[model samples]
Structure formats: structure tokens, C-alpha cells
Target chain A: MRTRWIFGTILMLTLVMGCAKKKIETYPAGVSSNQQIGAQTKPYVTNHQEEQTLSSVQEQQGQTVEEQNLQEEKLKQAQQEKEDIRKIIAKRIFFDFDSYELKPEARKILQQKAEILKKHPEIKIVIEGHCDERGTEEYNLALGEKRARAAYEFLILLGVDANRMQIVSYGEEDPLDPRHCEAAWAKNRRDEFKIISSK
Target chain B: MKKFLLFSLIIGLFGVDFGWAKPLRVTIYGPAESKIYVFVAEPINLDGKKNSIMVQEVVQCIKVKLKLFPFFKQLSPKDILEQGKINDVARIDYKKFFLSRADIVITIGERYLPDTGKTRIELRTFDVFKQKMILGKAFDLTNQRQVVLMVRKYLGDLLQLIMGNKAFFVNPIVFVHKGIKKSSIYQIFADGFGLKKLADIQGIVLSPSWSFDGEKIVFSVIQHEQHKLGILDLKTGNMQFKKLPGNSCISPVFTPWGDIAVSLDFSGSPDIYLLDKQLKIEKALVKHWGIDISPCFDQSGSKMVFTSSRLGNPHIFLFNLHNNQVERITYEGNYNTSAVISPDGRLIVFSRLTPEGHRIFVHDLKTGQEKQITFGPGNDEEPFVSSDGYFVVFTSNRSGKYKLYYTTINGDGPYLIPTNNISTFSPSWSWVEEKYF
Candidate 1:
């Protein structure tokens, strides 16, 4: 009887270990830049501000025009590297205003995202649906959810596993741009991907 | 209590306080932060019930206690003080306000102290452009807290009326937050204050609509691997669920007699259904070409506002139950969906896709004028008007996270729900309670 009890304990421990191992086997989907996309300055403003700061730094260095050009190129390259990190950190799929029906442009973006998921099958992702400032907060949230769901379904159709994907809607609480312009509004309506974990 | 006693004294002064040999004109200036000056009529009356002069004492207390409404100061005495004749309400001329820049204007009935314990505080709201009184409010206060509350509520209201409601206080907002990924449906307040988790569910829950009573919320939920319609009692925190046949249930609207009108797309394309209080399918409301979704019952449940894709693109359409006549309401936007009619049924707020992106817009059914409410980055969509029709709660990515935001109906600074935690979405705000006051 003691031997049998010991055997049962061993089986329970093995099952727990197996479950943990399975969860750990999945590769983290999407890049985790921890870039704090929100804490960063508005995208448009950040880009413009970086350009100005780069120019000032070049002047301070007292480099030749060609040297300044080289330095500027390096700055651009560095900024691009950071942005590349942001992109890998998460891929944002854009959408048309109000319509959750994936636009042709959105399909193209999703195709690229699909490729990433295919390359990283062990990764799990959460698709965030977003909207611009427009309607009621509640409605925008639902629409955003729909938008994210559209992207999720598209990916699933593209062979992405449903278990590996989850969706959440931010509605319009977070805006990539804070301005009240058409350009800003367009940027706000989007579906973005976040990698929850890696195998 | 203190505020009330002080306010009463201010009222008393209105009669004898401003009245002087020469009516000294006074005007409140600057923002709420600035000290409001009285521009008194010199030396002042040294004797006028000094002990019982609660108004002066109250003014002194306000000068000391409140940071916003400061004690009135005396402006320089002049028969015709210039300063550009005080054109705007923000900038008023003492000369124009009072013919002479003297201290006070003694006008009968301008200040009145009733014999009863209750004090009637009369407020005259003036139009800056016309320099004429456009509205008036009378606050009957018997105590201090009531005085403070009255002042706060009415002062803000008056400010809104003066500078327009758009520039005023934070409008009420509503949104739903899920637990982790899928948990319960919670409502977000406008000022980002009250958060009440309305439902507990294991499956997916979707759009919620306010009943005419505003006490119950009707929302679509998925449970037991089946789609169901649910009504949540705000008071009791009890939820009643009625199962539908298919796996897809979208918008749910509550009608009279506890009946619900819902748009169920489970049967291929979207269609409308009327369900009794028990969640039993009553009948099909509409089964036509294309998809029909986002149905909201009007005040009387006589007509419903819904989105239909019959015309190729989705647009808001009204369906009359009695006549079975469907008419399109929006023509400008290519995609206009998720329309919620106002409590009075005179206005509708909806989400429209424009060149600028998805935006919340309010359409005046009478005037045929559509006013855009959201601006900036992220698409603001699926706008639901509050029961009172004062504000809208919508979703935006202004926080770089899919969270909820509240905006005044006019769309000023969208009130971002302050949360850095998990994202919130698919907010269906309950109607404002009857006791919004």
C-alpha cells in the first residue's frame, strides 16, 4: 500500500511537469521591445523631433557637410533600427474608418503578419483592436473588437492556430497621435499584434 | 452649512450691499482662478447691521476658503471707466457694468432675504455677446452643504452655458472592461470614476444597450457553446439569460414588457428577432437582403435604429414595426453603423467611416445635420449615446492600448480612462439613471 501511494504521487508530479513543459514549449509570438509605445511621443511628432535633434547634434560636432550627411544617415539608421524593433515588437494592421470588414490594404498588412506567425508557430499573440476618436466610447470599443477579430480570423484562415491567438479591443482610449486632424485619426484606427510568450 | 450661511449673507447684501449714492458698476473678471472684484462705491456704509451682515462675513470667508471664487475688490472710482467697454464675459468693464466706477449699486430686489429659513439664491446668466441676461437659476438652500453642492453644480452649468457645453465639465462616459481576457462586462464612468462589473461570464459577451428604464442592460453573451441574450439588473446585480439557437448573437435591445429586440446573425446573414422576457423567440422582425445588425429600440419601442448592408455599404436604417417600412437615415458617409437613438428619439449618435477614419457622429434627425464628435489618432467607432444624450462613450487607441474614452457629445478632449493595465473594449454604456441629479 505504501509503494502504491508513492507511485500515485510520482504520477501526479509527472503530470504537472508535463503541462508546464508543454506551455513552455511554445515560442513567444511577436517582438517584445517593451518600447512602451504609449510613453513614446506621438509617432509623427517623435519622428519630426528626432530629425531636429539629429541636426542639432551634427552642428555641435562641427562636422563637414559630407560628414554631417554621414552622421545624419547614421542617426536615421539608428532611428530605423529602433523602429524595426518596434515593428518586430508588434505589427500594426491598419483599417478603414468604422468598417471592421478588412480592407485590401489591411489584408496586405495581415499577410506580412501571417508570415511572421508562420515563421514562429510556437508563439502566442494577442491582437489589439483600436479605433480613433469619433463615436461613443462603448461603441468604438465593440467596433475595435470586431476589427481585431477580423484580423484574428484572417490569420486563423492563413493557418495561424486559434489557441495561439487572442484578441482585445482598446476602442479609442489610446491614440498614436493626439491631434484632432484627419491624418491623426487615420493613424488611430488600427489592429496591432503583441507576442504574449515564446517557446 | 458654512457655504449656505455665507451665500445667504451674499444674497442679503444684494439689496443694500450694491446700492450706493452712485451705482458703482462691478464685473467679475478672468477665469475661475482670478479674484472677482466688486469695484465698490468708496468708504462704504460703515453701519448696516454689522453683526448680522452675514453677506460681508461670508464674502470674507470665501476670500479665505475658496481658491476659485475670491472676494470682490474695489476698482478705481471713475464715472466712465474704459478698458474697451468690457466686451466679453471674461473681460468686463467696471465703468460699463456700473455707470460710475463707484463701489456698489443699490438696486431693490437685486438682493432679497426671505423671512423663512430657506434662502433663494437667484443667479442671472448673461450672454457675453448681447450683454443681456439669457438665463436665470434660483437655488433654494437651507444649509451649507446644499449651498456648496448647489454652487458647484450650477456654477459649472452656468459656465457651460456661457462658454458652451463643449468647453465645460467632463462629460459622462461608459465602457466595458473584461477580466484578464474574458471575464465579466464592466461599465466605465465618464470621469473614469465608477467601475461596476455588470456581469460574470465564462464565454464572450458583446454589445450592451440601455433599456428605457436605464435600470436594466441588455447584452449579447456566448455561453454553453451557444449564443444567448441577457438582461442585467443594475440594482440587484442579477443576470437573466435566454439562449438563442445559433452561435452568433450581436446587438440586443430591450423593449416594453421586458421584451427584447435583437439582431442575430447566427442564421447566415444578420437578421432581427423579437424575444419575449423569458428569452423565447417571439418572431422574426426582418429577414431581407444583405446583413442587418446593430439594432437599438426607440423610447416607445415602436421603431428601431439598425445598420444594414443591403445597399452594398453598411448604413443606419430605421425600421417601423407597425408599418414594416424601412428607410435609410444616413446618406453622406459610405459606412455608418451602430446607431443609438436619443431618449427623446430626436437625435441619433453613430459611428461613420470617413476619409479621416472611423469617427463618432451625431445626426439631428430633424435638421439633417451631422456633427462629428471624435478627432485625432485612432478610429473612434461604435458610438452609443447616453440615456441623457449629453455624452458618448467610445473606443480609441489614444493611450496606445485599446482602452475606453468618454467625450462630450461635441467631441472635445476625449477623456482617456486612466489605466495602464489590461486593455478594455466593446463598451456598452448603461443609460444614465433617472436620479442623475
Candidate 2:
């Protein structure tokens, strides 16, 4: 009984080795092998020409993964910079009744805006000046222009390029708040920054 | 006694067709106390019953037009009818009018012609003190809508006989109506009828000024964060916007030579500049460093009055175009603005800001006298002089919401012009020709 089992194991080992040799010869020489022969021969040739093609493909995929990771990092950074710009330009400075002089808080806010503008040299901005409803429409227009010019002059003094900024005055029109109260008036008299271009 | 003889001589010379032949010269000045009493009789319907409503409408319109004359104290028809029945010129008792202290009596007769579908109105004016029929006229109207026009025509002729000055009846006023999201331009007759929306701009409209021919209007509009020059064709209803090279565009006025003069800040400060009809910069008219704005010109365009901050505050300055001379006319107030010259170029009307509120003031150029024409609990601003130089129209918030109000040069009447409930601003009055109506 022992002699019969040993003969059967020897016969199976010989059959597996013969099939592996045939797959290596056929696949390396650009010959199409049957599905059954290719499936049976996959595990045997780790150091053959078939092995070289598999390892080279793995290396190419590894390089692509690294490149994709780098691209995603750059996209995230650009989105973050855009969000920062939006937050900074959204801040508006207030003014007093019939007055265009900048207060202390306004100066501080303008300083921060100047710093951002300095960092982003490609950005262009327009400063809009507005007023409350207490004065005549014509005079208020001149007053609003004075207010916008005040901000423009200040931004110029802060090392920002003069050519990078433009100013406009809306006078007593285009109020930020429509209510006829002190609080609304305070809000209406303001200077708002708008991004004209960023590239 | 002399006044009576002069009146009789004038009436005798001109006869019944006096207003058609030549305008009579009669000058009456100052407030209501010095005004002559005018008695308007209740209108009579010739058909007695069929045309009573039309007659009433005509009489009502006549009364409204009479109120616009500050030199005439209108006696209510009820008060005159209570004295006696005055159905015709022959039935008018001069003794009763004299008893009522009426200096003049006006009788109206309206008859509807059923065949032609028209109404014929006969108007007569009698001098009560002289006891003479001074004027008579007839008007034919095809519809009820012409009642205001007929009244205006009759009053215009009657005014020609009473006062040699031009009448303010057929003239129209353009003003700004402040809405929620935007403001619109509206034109209304001086008699408070025919209110029309000239333009519904998408932004705030300010300082509307009429052209000399009354065919176009120039105004400033705030849109897209800047002030733009807007020209509206009154006849075609077409609007044209021009982007001026400045951060601000303020009050714009049409020069007598048919050009535009506006305030622009292109040279780093607000200054008056002249532009052609196409809105091209012709030249700088008034250039200064201290915020010059609100340019107003006299009838001949020889003199211009504008508000300037050159003297540390806004004050009215008169600029003579002929001599190139600039003189400061207002020295009383720190805040004086929106000054308009009278048609006769003798008086300047403006608004002055006080502790209480803004008030209308008239500065006489000849007499060098400054008189406050408005005493307001709320702000009164944007005073515009009538063509006759007797009436001044302004916007006031005395009735809780800003509306148009008219007073005489002597500040006699503060009658409210019915413009519904919307807040109005910047009334610009112009004398439109009758054909344009």
C-alpha cells in the first residue's frame, strides 16, 4: 500500500512542473496560450519574463499614486487660500454721521486688509463708499467720494500699489441697512472692499 | 382813488378783449394781508340739470387754480352764495361783493352740447371796486379730462389782465419719488393734476433738472456703486446713461445754450463741468478744491449759483459767466445748498439747515436781503422757484412722510401738493409750452 501512494505523488509533481515550463515558453515568445494553461501556470514563474512584466506594472502604479497625492494637496491648498480671501474682503469699516474720517477700529481692519493684499499681489480691489440718509443727495455724493478717497489714500500709504485699487462712491443710496435709526445709519455709512480680479 | 381811476382807464382802453390785445401791468407784492380778495361764484349749468356735474367739476378746478396765485385771497363759493344767488354776470350784485370785501368777482357758465359731444365754458372777471367787466373768454372742451386745461387757460388769461408777469398754470414740475429698492422720476402739473412717472430707474435718482425746451431732463443716478449721468427724453420716454470719469456726479443743470453743466470729481475734487448734449466733457465751468456742486443758472444763463464748501462749509456762490467772476452770496448759514435763481434774476431761493431742521430761504440779489421762507417742524429742503417768481415749491416731511409743498416768495402758503403717500424729493419746476401738454 505505501509503494502505491508514493507512485501517485511522484506522478502529480511531474505533471505540474511540465505545465509550468510550457506556459513560460508560450507567453514569453508572444504566443497566445489557452485559458486553462495560463491559469494553472501563474504561481511558478517568479523570476521569469512574465514576472518582470508584473513587477514593472506595480512600479508604474506606485508612481501614479504618488503623483495623484501631490495633485490633491495642491488643490486643497488653493481652496484654503480662496476661503481666506473671501473672509478678509467681507469685512467692512463704518463711519460716523456726515463724517468720513476713519476711526481707530477702521484703521486696524484696513491694516489687516493691506497685509493680505500685499501677500496676494495679483488681486485687484475696488473700495466702495456709502452714506446715511440725513443729508441732501448731491452733497452726500461728494461726501461719499471723500470717504472712498480716504480709504484709497490709506491703502496706498500701507505699501499697496496704487494701481491695484479703484474707488467708487454710492452716496446716500445703496444703504447697507434700510431702517431709519441710529443703528441702521451707522451701518449705512461704511466702506466696503470688493475683489475685482484675483489672477 | 387813484387805483380805481387807473383800473377804469385801463379797462376802458382795452375793452372786453383786453387780455387778447395786451397784458396789463399790475404789481402786487408781499403776504396774504396785502393780497386782494377774489370771489369765485358757483358755476351755473346752462342746461340746468344735464350739465350740473360738469359745471361743478369746472368750478372745482377753477378754485384749485386760483389757490396757486398767492396775491389773491380766494373767497369760498359757499361764502359768496350765502350772500346771494349769482348765476350770471348780470345777476352778480357788486354791492354784496363789496360788502364781502371782494376786490374781484369771477363767474363761470358751462353748457354741454349734445349734438357735438362737447362742452362750452364761458368765463368772466369783473372788478368789484370799479364795478366793471374787465375780461371775458370762452373755451370748448371735448371731454371731462380737459377741465383742468380749460381752467388753466382761463386763469392764464385772467392773470395776464391782473398781473403782467407770466403765469405758473401750464408749467410742470419734475421730482424724485423715493421707493423701497429704487427711486423714480415723476412729472406733475403745477396745478397738482396729471401726475406721471417719467422714468423708473433701477437706482437712486437725484437732482432732476429740465432742459430749456422742456423736452428732456438731466439727472444723476447712483448705480453699480457709482453715480452716472442720466438723460431722459421727456417726449420719447427713452433713457440714456453716460459713465462720467469721476467718482461722483451731483446736481446737473442745462445751460441756456442747450448744454449740460454738472458736478464731477475727476480732478480729485468736486467741480462744475460743462458737457455737450451727448454727455462729452466740453470744459470745466467751476473748478475748485473744496467740493463745488449744485449748479443753477438764471433764465439767460448769464449768472450761475452753486453750493461750494470752499468757505469751510457749504455756501451758495454766484458765478457770472460773462465776466468770469465768482462771488459768495450766502454768508448767514454754515449749511446752505440747492439755490435756484428766479426767472427775473432778482431773487435766489435755497435751503438752509438749522438746529430744528432745514428751512427754505430766499436771498434777494438786488436788495441783498435774506429771508427764511419756511418754518418747519420737519425738514424742508430742495426749494424750486416758479416761472413767475412768486411761488416756491419744496419737499417737506412735516406730515410724517416727505411730500411736495408750495409757498409764495413771501412764505405765505404752505399748501400740500397731493402726491399720494410716497416720499418725494428734489422738485424741479419748468415752464412747459402749452402744445407739449
The lDDT of each candidate is: 0.60, 0.80
lDDT for A65 (candidate 2): 86
lDDT (10s digit) by residue, model 1, range A23-123: 44432335232543443454433445778999888887766777879989999997795465447648676777666788887788777777767776777
Q: In order of the candidates, what TM-score does chain B achieve?
A: 0.63, 0.88
**Highest-scoring model, lDDT:** 2
Number of the top DockQ candidate: 2
What are the TM-scores, per candidate, against the unseen true structure? 0.49, 0.83
In angstroms, give how far residue A85 of model 1 lies from its true place.
38
- Candidate 2 differs from the real structure by a C-alpha RMSD in angstroms, to one decimal, of 6.8
Root-mean-square deviation per candidate? 25.8, 6.8
Best by TM-score: 2
Model 2 docking tier (incorrect/acceptable/medium/high):
medium
On residues B99-217, what C-alpha lDDT tens digit does candidate 1 reach at each position?
54233221111123467665454443332223333334555556544634444444445334323332112333334555533556665555443455556776566676666556777
